[model samples]
Target: MSQPYLAPAELTAEFCGRLLDALDAPLALDHVCVDFQAVKSLDSSAVALLLEWHRRAQAAQRQLELMHLPSALSQLIKVYGVEEFLQIKA
Candidate 1:
């Protein structure tokens, strides 16, 4: 498989808007995987971005996969009770 897309070092509210805007382009593949290894910090906005991505992927008949999520981000997703809405992989 091809390498997954790398997430930015920061996925905070201050940056996620731009990140979301960047995702406006059409996905070139049926499955979209994003790697979070470079993401050192994030907030609830990250969750929002994931939700939006998932929504977009579903609308386009594509699948979204997230990998290597930081523990903090994982906790935030769990805390917000949105894990069921996202597809996270180890």
Candidate 2:
């Protein structure tokens, strides 16, 4: 598996393109994890990005795990009703 992806501090719509671009790179691993420890801010767009990444991972026949998710973000994910889909790590 590849090293966990470190998320940017500011997870907003402005960074979506760059984040998506990074994901566009070919990943040979069967499982991937995104570390959210560095992320201090998040918005609906961030949630959308995560969902998109999960979709891409599924399409690629890989598993996506979100690690070290902040409480705020976790709450947001629950609010958005996607905790099961995102498979957030404890």
Candidate 3:
């Protein structure tokens, strides 16, 4: 398997595009893992970006797994009722 995509310390609107761009090259893989352990802060925009990435993965018939999500971000995703879609790792 390929190495997990490491999220930046900050996943705000300004940095999400860079992450997305980085992902473009890896979408061909059957499975993709995004490591969120380093993310110290994120707004709703980060959630949107994640959802978009999920959508892209689905469209490509790929699997997207989000790993080591920070507690705050996990709560945000739960609040939005999208944990299933985001596939947050335990």
Evaluate residue 60 in candidate 2 and report its C-alpha lDDT on the 0 to 100 scale. 84
Q: Cα RMSD (Å) per model?
A: 2.1, 1.9, 1.8
Cα error, residue 7 of model 3, in Å, equals: 0.7
Model 2: how far residue 8 lies from native, Å: 0.9
Over 1-90, each residue of candidate 2 has an lDDT whose tens digit, in order, gives: 778888899888887767875564534455787888999887888888888898898888888777888888888888999888887643
Provide TM-scores for the models: 0.86, 0.86, 0.86
lDDT of candidate 1 over 46-81, digit per residue (tens): 999988888887887777778888999999889888
Answer with 1 or 2, whichever has the higher TM-score. Answer: 1
Model 2: runs farther than 4 Å from truth? Answer: 26-28
Clashes of 3: 0
Model 3 residue runs over 4 Å out of place are none
Indicate the worst ten consecutive residues by lDDT in candidate 1: 21-30
lDDT of 1 at 20: 79
What clash pairs does model 1 have? none
Kindly provide the TM-score of model 3 when superposed on the true structure, using C-alpha atoms: 0.86
- Model 2, residue 68: what's the lDDT? 83
lDDT, each prediction: 0.81, 0.79, 0.82
